[model samples]
Target: MNEYSLLVLATQYSFTAAFAAMAAGTLYFMMERNNLTPEYSPVASLCAMVSLVAAINYFVMKDTVGLDGQAASLAGFATDYRYIDWLITTPLLLAVLPVLLGRSRMNNGMMARLLAVDVLMIVVGYIGEVSINRAGGGTMTGWWCLLISMACWFYILYVLFAEIGRALEGADSYLKSSLGFLRTYLVISWVVYPLGYLIAVLDLSDNLLIGREMVYCIADVIAKVGFGMAAVSVAKRLSAMQWEARS
Candidate 1:
């Protein structure tokens, strides 16, 4: 009926979903590490790492789910742990791009720059979110941090698409094709974060909180587990090709 109730329900569901992601990630990592090639271990492990991070976040946020006004205010209305999760996991997710594309193609300098920007995006975004709780000039600081974070995000996308274009152009057919889907997936899946950010910050309605948690839960599953599978697919294809050439 109200936003609080909705958020309470959403939070319960999120716990289940987050746990599932972590379990799936664990299974994936074990299978890949034992059965798949060494090249895929990093991808599998990173996937597991992000899923585990999400799991931790859901646990951290459990305390604030359905409290009333005074209780909620005392408990802190926002879940800063989500941003901390993002800070750790996002760069790991992005690292997949270079791993798949080959470092020479992505280049060490560009990769470092991308990671730095990614860190900035999460850190600034967290600062912005927390600043909303401050008194006096807090609102303005929050907006500024958010704006800077968004700029950093857009810049990262620019590097992924515009700068990486040349490298993709020269990639083999399999890599080109697989990476095409990956690029599209990254763009689409990432759009969910800003929407989550808006909802989480504005606290527009209880439904918005519900929407935010659900979106984040679904997005994590897709971004981490789904993308990990994609990397595995590419690695498998490459392995198969190598075998064929040798045979």
Candidate 2:
């Protein structure tokens, strides 16, 4: 089969797999929700919501690839389903990090600002994707949207590192370390999306395009399910921090 067909199959199956993973994550988190103390209860719910949203999107995306006649075009991103998925899910995933710290460490203002920036980042990145993917550029052209989105991304990281990390100053080492790892992993996974968009801009070979879609699907699974599971583990640890003393 040709590259377009190959890309569709590869991504379709990948989305199916992510769908299963996310569904499992949602069930797992919901089952564990009631087991946690009130302080950590929202952790499970937040995680479940993330997984559920991702699962639904993956299902829709895979179907779109196979049935909605997804096609590659120099004029526009073929897999814009992924963008729609990211628009909703990215903010929820971002919320996982701060929510783990509870309201005390991440106040309402901070959480709102962080999520707002995340929305801006994704929205602008989508704009960049559409602009650059167009046959001869959409409204804007070439890297402006990409650069602005990158700046927003960097701002979010600044908040995570400088502001949120400050809030984490007195947290247990285990919790802090776990959060650090989760944040890094999620950020790195997120990098794949923009890189794929860049590849589209380069007008790379179909092989590269196929590879990009496959990679994007795999990374989506990791980004969604991995974050939820890791967040659950960290939340439980923090919830039980007082177990020894109380016992």
Candidate 3:
């Protein structure tokens, strides 16, 4: 890569690292604010922390990874992506499981159904990723993974928006705030992955040259930052609400 390309990569890494730190902090605060009963808090926090750690590791090691060829250091990228997916989605599934199983008293049938759908979507995503990795030619299987990821993202956004609407209906400030943050975060964060896939699929590198790699890096950074911000915003909102109720 040229000097400009190298600079772009460095910038991207910095952005991603910053976001990872923010995510970790956000999750820590969330656990404390929500009073997430030891059982759920640890898992949720683990999700955020793992994501943060993976991002940082990727950022640090990005320079060492080759991205010039078809067989470029894909293993490192795949490993990081897998870690992120597992961390982010697994805890979310855990949180939703209770609602789906009818163990929670919150009693929103629609939300429960949405959670179930989210779980299914995540499952599909994992399968798609596995298929892509095994196929290795980045053809049908890669497209399938990209498509499934987009589908799942849209559904998740729908769920967040629906929750926010419901919270508004009840005038529940905390829930509304939480949902709003989630909506913003999801929308922004999810954009990166799709964009990266699009760039790859379209073969935009022909025109952009090494700049294309920078695009992927930038996308990763944006997504991580959005996630971190959303987590922190939700945690703060919940904490304030709890304090208000107590007073």
- C-alpha local distance difference test of each model: 0.70, 0.75, 0.50
Question: Could you tell me which 10 consecutive residues in candidate 1 have the lowest summed lDDT?
Answer: 66-75
Error of 1 at 5 (Å): 3.4
Provide the global lDDT of candidate 1 against the true structure.
0.70
TM-score for each predicted model, relative to the true structure: 0.84, 0.86, 0.59
Tell me which residue pairs clash in candidate 3.
none
Candidate 2, residue 91: the lDDT equals 84
- For model 2, residues 1-247, the per-residue Cα lDDT tens digits are 2234545555557767888888998999999887677877788888888888888877776555553224452213355677777888888888878777767777778778888988887787777766766654334454777778778888888887778788889887887898888878877878887788778666777667767777887888788888778888888877787565578
Ranking by lDDT: 2, 1, 3
Task: Give the per-residue lDDT of model 1 (tens digit) for 58-145.
Answer: 6566455533422233234355777787889889888877777865676888889999999999999888777764542337777787
The parts of candidate 1 lying over 4 Å away from their true place are 1-7, 62-78, 134-138, 200-203
TM-score of 1: 0.84
Runs with alpha carbons beyond 4 Å of true place in candidate 2? 1-8, 67-78, 136-142
Clashes of each: 1, 2, 0
TM-score of model number 2: 0.86
Model 1 has a clash total of 1
- Write the residue-wise lDDT of candidate 3 on 59-87 in tens digits: 55554544444323323445344345444
